[model samples]
Target: MRTKEAGAAMDSEFHVQCPYCGEELDIYLEPDVQGTLIQDCEVCCNPWKVEVWWDGDERSVAVSRGDGSE
Candidate 1:
């Protein structure tokens, strides 16, 4: 039988602000690191397509409207 190990579960959070309402939000990204690209605002419910780029030592994140409309 498989047994669970201590500290094996994901335990990391990424905090970011909502693009529409500018509300701060914390999103858990331990298990879903790659899946954390796009996220919707909880307050305004706006769809934000996030892009994260890492250049060796530096990391950058950008958020923009999912739709083509400005």
Candidate 2:
């Protein structure tokens, strides 16, 4: 799993790069939630998958193209 860039302002927010267009995105995830969800890049408008989860005490996120490649 990839390490998450936590937003200093909120634990629920994370900074991630859009896999399609390389746009930087700030995404919000609910606490104790773990799953992959489809999200569109705010800048490029291309659809992708956002996988959010936690490993032990560390929050992690992985973005993947719509084709499912990371």
lDDT (tens digit, per residue) of candidate 1 on 1-70:
5555323333345567777888888765443344236677778888988766544543445677766566
Per-residue lDDT of candidate 2, residues 17-53 (tens digit): 8888878888887766678888788898887787877
Clash pairs, candidate 2, are none
Error of 1 at 53 (Å): 2.0
User: What Cα-based lDDT does every candidate model obtain?
Assistant: 0.61, 0.76
Collision count of model 2: 0
For each candidate, what TM-score against the reference? 0.55, 0.71
- Stretches of candidate 1 above 4 Å error? 1-12, 31-36, 57-59
For every candidate structure, what is the RMSD over all alpha carbons to the true structure, in angstroms? 5.0, 7.5
State the weakest 10-residue window (summed lDDT) of model 1: 5-14
